[model samples]
Target: MKKPVAAVDPLRLLVAILLLLPLLALMGFGMLWLWQSGYLLYWLIAMVVCGVLGYGLQQLLVRQERQLLMNAATEPNPEWPPSADAVWQQVEALSATCNPEDWPLEDGRWIWDLGQKALETVAHCYHPEVDKPLYELTVPHTLLIIERASRELRRDIAEKIPFSNRLTVGDLFRIQRWKVKAEKAFNIYRAGSILINPVNALLSEAWRHLRERSFDQARNELHRWFLRAYVCKVGYYAIDLYSGRLALGDENYAESVTPESKADLEQTEQTAEATNEPLRILVLGRSNSGKSSLINALFRELKTVTDVLAGTTQALEPFVLSREGFTQALIFDSPGCDSPFFDSKQMLITAGSADLILWVSPANRPDRQAERQFLDALRSYQAARMDRRSAPLLVTVSFVDRLRPANEWHPPYDLTDTTNIKSANITAAVRAIAADLAVPAEQVIPVCLLEGKIYNVVDTLWSAILNHQDEALRIRLMRCLDAKKRAEDWVLLRRQMAGAGRFLRDLPEMLGKRSEH
Candidate 1:
């Protein structure tokens, strides 16, 4: 039989040695002095004192060493021997035998297996608590292993599954559920790890490969493990963008108009005749879609710019334009419409109050997502107002000047002219999009808002709004606007009442008691 190696307690041995050495040296000195000077009593006292000191020192050293050992072993990274490698290999072997399809209904066993592997690795590397199992390990190491295994598993799933097949109802439902679980695991294992680091860069490269249908290269990139763990998150955003569910880029103005702003504009309109009623036009489009520049062009004022990107307008701003014959129009500049945060309910409320809806789309890059959303909103609003006359919905194709050849600095004809050839081309493009949305082709109008001469564009829009003969719609819109204004005032009154109540309650406290004290 092989002899068992003795387990050496480093802390106990260190303490014993530290306490023994000084006493031994003192005893030798006392013996030499006592023999030379016949100081037997002094030697006796010194021996007793050294005995007590040694005992106390031994206890202190032992306690200190115990603490030091415990701390070093439990720290985030502990050095371990080759046994850790063996444990990891064992985990990898177990994982290789397990198929996700054979797991529980929740499919959580795979994650559990990964967690176990991480714990096993940590266990082989560090000393466990006296009462705990030898295979159990620290939380951080377990998290690391779980994250690594999850990446591998997800990559495998992605490779084995085809994208087209993944779109089936059952597959999509399963994938969505799996994503939720995976996201939870990621948060637990590596929260805040997705913020534009080297990991994200590698993930982006992996995503490109995946996008190109190069699953092999994508898998290779994903094999990096840490980067692949963020794949589901990236995939979610990708689907949103490609499916027209999430609009890309930013918006130049507030996409939704506040009830208060709508009311104020509406009240200003009812004071005049139908033609004289301020054209409370709501300008909308995707981010960087030239909404602000169009408004500036319509008013013949440099109030807003073309270069402004999406989400630039945080609030609805009302601009009053004074026309000839003392007529005025209230044009509300709103935020970009195609925002992920956009609320269609609020938009309906805003647009419903408008005399005309000027739906804008950029001429250069017509975003399909914005176009779809705009059409949906228009159709929904029109349906809701079926009993009343429909508000005139004019499609303004903006930024025609930017669609020219690189060699040409500017277009030959004025962009605002409906009869101009370039304008005609723009009109046709808008008409095609409108036709697809089931909108009337005659409703589409083209305008280059960046150019100074856009009077014709403004004139055309004014003409359409004036031709609309819906007294019922006009009355309904006025009533809605009035109700919204009243609600706002009521809220303000409640706040004022609360403030007054607080003041009354504090009055007695503020008034000093009689001098009975």
Candidate 2:
């Protein structure tokens, strides 16, 4: 749609030279008059002093700008690997040692070379022993990084650079060619001046040298600025790739979805089913550990069946729990661990989907072999996944009232006060439970889930759940991302298969047409 810029305009060049010639002659005559009058030396000295002062000011401003650019270059992302700091430092070192004179000023090929070198530097930090770690990148992931970097660069140029959108590559090259011609013309004029007046020429040259030195310094600084920006951009995406934040087939999906339409995609996730699946909170315990009672207490109602007998919950029962000040979640009450018919496989599946676990332990029970073994196995299963975040575990020591001094039925027992025997025994039981389950003492909350006596449910237990809400949300996000990626893969696979079948069906007809032709 746009016209290309001409390489040269002889008429325009002639007009410019003609315009400059009169001024040049007037300046030459004026200098000759000053030399004869013996004022040229004083004028030249003043010019030299002004040029030095101007150059000094320019240097100061440039140093401040360079400091800001370098600071941004060295700043590391929080998710970057431990060795990223050293890699960034290497980038800074490379930038410092770079010489603008060695680089082709007009050609942009060096920009690509700089990016490639930065990629290698980042890759080496990830695998120092390997000769080339370029194989670490998958095609889709590599394309993702390129797309993200290019999009960001384009955005910056459009938003920050003045009139950059109007300039084409050819236009820039044309400007560069004209600049070279101007420099040559200026040098020729300087040589001619020297031949005409050697003393004046010598003084003028001294003043001109200061200006030329400033130009060279500015050029070199600009060169370093470009190098740092390009290298840091590459490193930023490199960190994203190495940290697993840059996912394959994710960018395309994200790009297609607008902010207002994001809910459509969110609805497609497994966690976003009918009623927008609430955060799953799996309740685990031994027989008669008051697991059902704890769930009922949390809901402030008789949400699940609670009995003193073992195997009260014969299967996993899920109830959507929505509290005023708590995260909306699905509380699954499972069969007691001591039940003979307990399904470990089903439990594992439910546990895998859980964002949080509420392990209820009875204060009177000391033998916890069954609970401990199941917990260890569950933890191992979670660790093997590696992709998903581990669900936070909260131990609720129920039946605290039945611990010590059974006659003493107290409310608001302060465990900090060691003199209170009941409180001390309850605290001891909590610590014991924490130790047995390999959980932190702070994570273990003591509660009395008796029919009439409900303690710590609102003040302590709910607060712990709220505190772990962020972690649970992270786990949920990872789970949903996996589900989304799986769906995307299947859809793509089906599309490919359909295309292959269509091509085979039309193959014979196309071959017949080709033979007739």
Best by lDDT: 2
Q: Which window of ten consecutive residues has the lowest lDDT sum in model 1?
A: 73-82
Clashing pairs in 1: 250-287, 250-310, 251-310, 251-311, 252-310, 253-334, 253-335, 254-334, 254-335, 255-335
lDDT at residue 494 of model 1 (Cα atoms): 99
Error of 1 at 504 (Å): 32
Question: In terms of TM-score, how similar is model 2 to the real structure?
Answer: 0.64
Alpha-carbon lDDT, every model: 0.52, 0.75
Under the 3 Å rule for N, CA and C atoms, how many clashes does model 2 have? 0
All predictions: root-mean-square deviation over Cα? Answer: 30.5, 8.2
Expressed as tens digits, the lDDT of each residue in 284-399 for candidate 1 is: 66667777877787667777645655577765667766666423556777777766545667777777666666777776774466667666876777666532334567777766
Off by over 4 Å in 1: 1-279, 325-327, 385-387, 404-424, 451-455, 469-517
Q: Count the backbone clashes (under 3 Å) in each candidate.
A: 10, 0
